[model samples]
Target: MAGWIWRTAIGLAAIIAAGVASAQTFPAKAVHIFVPYPPGGGVDVLTRTLADVVSKNWGQSIVVENRPGAGGVIASQAIATAAPDGYTLIMVASGHATNPFLYPKLPYDTFTDFSPISLLASSPNVLLVRSDSPFKTVADIITAAKTKPGGLSYGHAGNGTSTHLAGALLNSLARIDLNAIPYKGGAPAINDLLGGQIPMSFNNGPESVGQLQAGTVRALAVTTATRAPFLPNVPSMSETVPDYDTEVWWGLLGPGGMPADLVAKISGDFVAALNTDAVKERLGKLGAIPIGSAPAAFVAKIRADYDKWEPIIKAAGMKAE
Candidate 1:
C-alpha cells in the first residue's frame, strides 16, 4: 500500500509540473481578441494595433473579431462564456465600466467574470458642430438647448454607450436638455453628423480628428478634465461647467481563471508593445494616449466607475433603448 501511494504521489507531481510548463509556453496557437465595437471605431483600432505587434513579437497570428450590439452586450457575453484559456481575450472600452449601471442585468458580471490585463489607451469625447454652424463654443450649445429643450440633439453608439453617457453627464452638469439620438454605432452617428442630420455630437477624438482637420466639422470642447493633445486649441467642457468631464477609455481583458504566470506574460508583453515607437506614433496620429496601466489599476477603475454611475444613471431614467 505504501509503494502504491508513493507512485500515485509521483504521478500527480509530474502532471502538476507539466501543467506549469504548458502555461509557460503561452500562445502556442493563434489567439483571438474580441473587440466589442464595430470596425473603424476607437476600441477596434487600439486592439488591432496591439494584436499586430504582439503577434509579430510572438511569431504567431492574432485575430480580432468584431461583435457590435446591445451596447457591447453580445460581445461581453460571448467572452464571458468562452473557455478560460488565454487564447480568448478582449479590448474593452469605457462602455465596459458603465454597462453594469446602465443595463439592469448584464449577461455577465464585469468584475467577477473577467480578469483585467491592462488599460491600453483612453480617447476623450469632443463636442462638435458642423463647420459653418452659428454656435461658436460649447456655451452656445448649452444656451440653445436650454432655450429650446429637445431642440438640440447629440448622437451615440447606443443607449448605454460612453458617448450616450457623455451627453447625459453634459445635460446634468450644464442643467440643460440636449436630447440623445441613438445609432447602431459611432460610425453611423458620425456619418449623420457630417450629413447635417444631427446638429452636434460628442464623438471620440480619432473619429473626428480627420473631419475636424478637413474643415468638415468644427469642434467646440473635449470631454476630458484637460484638453486633448490632438486638439490643443479645443477647450475642455469642464472649463465652462465645473466638474464636467467625459471620455471613452479602452483596455484589454480576458475570460476569468487565467493563471498568474500567464496573466503576467500577457500584461507585460502588451505594456511593452504599447511603448514601442511605432505604436506611439500611430496612436498620436489618432489623438490617443497610450497608457498601458496595471491590472489592479484597471480593475479599480472599473469598480469605482460602477459605483459612481449607478445612482447617476438611475436618476437619468436611462434604459437600453
Candidate 2:
C-alpha cells in the first residue's frame, strides 16, 4: 500500500509539471483568432488592434482570419472544432449568446463547445433619427408608438442582430407596436433614416457615433442599462422603460476543455493589454468600453444573455435570415 501511494503521487506531480511547462511555452508558433464577420467591421477591427498589441508583447505572430457567412455560424463552427490549444481562438460578438436561439440546428453546442476566456468590450446601440426629427426621447417614442400602433417603424441591421433585438426589447417593454424594418446592414439602414425612408434606427455605436458627431442624426437613448461612457450625454433606455437594457459586446473564446492554467495565462495577457493606455484610447475612439472581465465573469455574462434573450427571440419569432 505504501509503494502504490508513492507511485501515484509521483505520476500526479509529473502531470502537473507538464501542464505548467506547456502553458509557459504556449503558442510556440503563430496563433490564429478567427473573426466571424467580414473585414472592417467592429469585431474585426477590435481583434486586429488587440492582436497587434499582444503579438508585439509576446514576440509571436497573431493572425486574424475573417470567415464571414450565415450570420457568423460559419466561423463559430470553425472555432468549435478547432484544437483546444491556445493557438486556436475566436473573437465573438454578442450574437454568440443569441445564435443558439436563432439557429436551432447549430453544428456545435454554443455553451459546451467553447470556453469563455474574456469579455473584451461593449458598446451600446444608439437609437437615432434625423437631427431634425421631432422625437427627442424614449418617452416620446413610446408615446407615439402607443398612440399609433404599427405607425412608427425603426430600421435595424438584420433580422437577428443586436440592432434588431434592441428595437424588439423596446417594443416589448414599452408595450407599444413599432414596425421593425430589417435592412441588409446598418449602413443602409442609416442611409434610409437620413433619406426619410425610415423614421428611426437602432444602430451600433461604431456606425452611429460618426453621424452623431457630425450632427446629422440625434440620439434618443442608448440601448444599455446605463448611459454609455463614449456618449455620456445620451440616456439609457432603462431610464425610461425601467428594465430596457441591451448592448453590442465582444469577447474572446477558445475551444472547450482548455487547461485552466493556460486559460488563466491567456486571459491575463489580454486583460493586461486591454488596460494599457494606448489600447484604451484606440477602443475609446471606436466607441467601445473595454471590459477585460474574468473568465468566470465572462461565463456568467454568456449565460445571462443566453437566458435573457431566449424568450425574447422566441416570442418575437426571430431567426437567422
Best by TM-score: 2
Give lDDT per model, in order: 0.85, 0.92
Clashes of each: 0, 0
> Could you tell me the TM-score of candidate 2?
0.95
The positional error of residue 237 in candidate 1, measured at the CA in angstroms, is 0.8
Candidate 1's TM-score: 0.91
Worst-scoring 10-residue span by lDDT in model 1: 15-24
lDDT tens digits, residues 1-321, model 1? 999999999998996675577578887999999887778878888889888999998888999999877777888898888887689998888878878776778889888889898988988888888888889988889889989998889988678777788898988888888899988776788789889999888778788788888899888899888998888999999999999877778888888876656777889999999999999999999989899988888998888778867777887888886
lDDT per residue as tens, model 2, 116-141 = 99999999999999999999888999
lDDT of 2 at 207: 91
Q: Tell how far residue 164 is off in model 1, in angstroms.
A: 1.0
Model 2, position 137: C-alpha lDDT score: 87
After superposition, the stretches of candidate 2 with alpha carbons farther than 4 Å from their true spots are 1-15
